[model samples]
Target chain A: MMNCKEATQLLSEKLDRPLDTKEKVMLGVHTAMCSSCKQFGRQMEDIRSLAKQYSKGKQTEEKK
Target chain B: MIEANPSLSASEAPNAALFYDQEFMESLRSQMVKFATLQVQDAQLAEDAVQEAMLSAYQNIDKFGRQAALKTWVFSILKNKLIDLLRKEKRTTVASQLENGPNLQGDALMDHLFKENGHWQKSERPQKWDDPDHGVENEHFWRVFDACLTALPEKYGRFFMMREFLEMATPEICHNEDISVSSLNVTLYRARLRLRECLEDNWYQAKESGS
Candidate 1:
């Protein structure tokens, strides 16, 4: 079984590139059993989206 | 030279008058400087790059009609300036050297977060982040976000910005920085882990406690 460290590393890499079949399978098995890893995966996705919004200058304030 | 896109009708394009608005210009300059500073990691150099990009934009503003959003056009120019500065400054070697520094030890933070068995440290496991989408919309949340990003180690922050903010592809970044794919992956992975941990501690937990 892939451990949380490996699982989380794969999750981060998923943001930069597509996972291979073997990696996808290992990550699937790991995250399926690990709630913490599952949550970590979700948060990674959230960070990516937040970073995108940030780059586009999305902000609520009218001034700095 | 900026060229007008014939495909864009007059109404579809952003109002050119916004270029002359003081508030708009101030906001644009701030955003540009913030981005450039993060990438170049030098305030004086960042300012110079932004000023040069803005000057070029101003000189060619007449030709900028309908080609792209004004902000996008300006940023493209700034991106070029940043690339030039980065090349001249030779930041890539510094980043790679830091990656190999004795203290790096293949990432001390990774060891702190993960146990010998590769499981999350009991106290270090990720907690539920409440309402992250809503958090992104909040101004205070952005402040926390910026603080977290800025707090990252300089090497990690620069590569993270190159990939995330500048939207450079992974291979492109590896080639430009002269690092291997695995090394870049490790850097980005560490960055995301640290950033998430920082936000959760400083922002979400604070909000939960305050409200």
Candidate 2:
């Protein structure tokens, strides 16, 4: 069973591109089984999408 | 005689004019100047940092990497320059900065992520981001996003801006900062979480009014 640490690392890198077959299988199986890991994966994906907005030509700055 | 009210606003805004013009340069200057002041808390020093970033950008216009848009490119330059300025300030003068490193936040790394009884923990888990029901055409989203960015501590906020806003790859970012790839990944994760949380608040408020 993949731990949260390993799963999250692979998830983060996957945002830029596809993972290897072995990694994909491991990550796929891990996320599918662990609800928390699934939630964490979803959040990481969401972060990538939202992060893309900052790359867009935003008319005004978003203050944090 | 031609002076107009600050509230009057421009009649027909020329967005493209921001590309290259004295006025546009001034706008960039002011933005960097203000952000720098906030982080370093030194007007003269901040001005110097802003000046360097602005001038360097102006000089290297042709080299502007198209990977990130213009605003992002400029911000990245300013961010790097600001870090240099802080390091310089810390090393030579500012005896106090030398002693305490001008850092108030204790264990900023631990504050960001730490283990308690061997369990990893963070301060707050941000809400998830969705491809909005109405989709990307939403007009006012950036305002909410920027607000969240402003609330972040300067160091984290700046790092987040470089990665997300500037489209800097994680490996490149880590190399630039001499940080590990995992460290950069976690930093980006936290930055996005905070932004998502803040944007969700705005979306909820909008929904309450309509529903």
Candidate 3:
């Protein structure tokens, strides 16, 4: 069983590279059972989009 | 006024007029300065880089037709200028700092979040962030996001931005920074963890409490 710490590290790693089958399976099982890891994964996705908006200078422009 | 005149070469006219627009130039300058300042961590050095970039961009305005957005071209120039400055000032504190590996403070923070058994400390587990998509549109929310990014230790912030903002690939970043793949992975992981906690504490929880 993967602990939350390892699960979280895999979560972050998947952003930068594709996970092998074993790693993906472990992450899927852990996150399915762990709401905290699940939420952490979702928030990481949110942060990626926020970072995109930030790169596009969305905050500096007025709301149109 | 130039748009009204068709006598000038059609290919070259519009962008030149845009390059000369006072409002567009001012806004672009401010954005460039902000980005440079964040990367270089020095106001005066950022200003110098932005000024040089803007000047070269203006001089090369003729080459800017239909190739890329003016803002994109200008930012590329600024990025190059910043790299040059960083390389030239090799022995300076900022350069030396970049060469330094992640600090002990970062390790302590990680230990605080994770227990000896590699489980999240109960109190440190991530919580739900409600309606995060909507939060992206909120101006105040972006301010909080910016603050969280700025709060990251300098090298971590730079690496995070290089990956996220600059959209550089992992291997490319490792090549540019001369770090091993595993170290880059660890740095990015720690950066994301800290950024997540910062946002949760400062924004999501505050919003939940209606504070």
Tell me the TM-score of chain B in each candidate.
0.68, 0.49, 0.64
Rank all candidate structures by their TM-score, best first, as comma-separated numbers.
1, 3, 2
> Candidate 1 regions off by >4 Å?
A59-64, B1-47, B56-77, B83-94, B98-106
TM-score of chain A of each: 0.87, 0.75, 0.88
Tell me each candidate's TM-score: 0.75, 0.53, 0.72
What are the DockQ scores of the candidates, in order? 0.49, 0.23, 0.50
The Cα local distance difference test for each model comes to 0.80, 0.56, 0.77
B110-181 per-residue lDDT for model 3 (tens digits) = 798999998889999998888776687677887899788877876777778878877778886666566778
Q: Model 1: clashing residue pairs?
A: none
Cα lDDT tens digits for candidate 2, B139-195: 556556556677665555655666655555666555555566666565555444445
RMSD of 3: 6.3
Cα deviation of B70, candidate 3, in Å: 10
lDDT of 1 at B131: 66
Query: Best-fitting candidate, measured by lDDT?
Result: 1
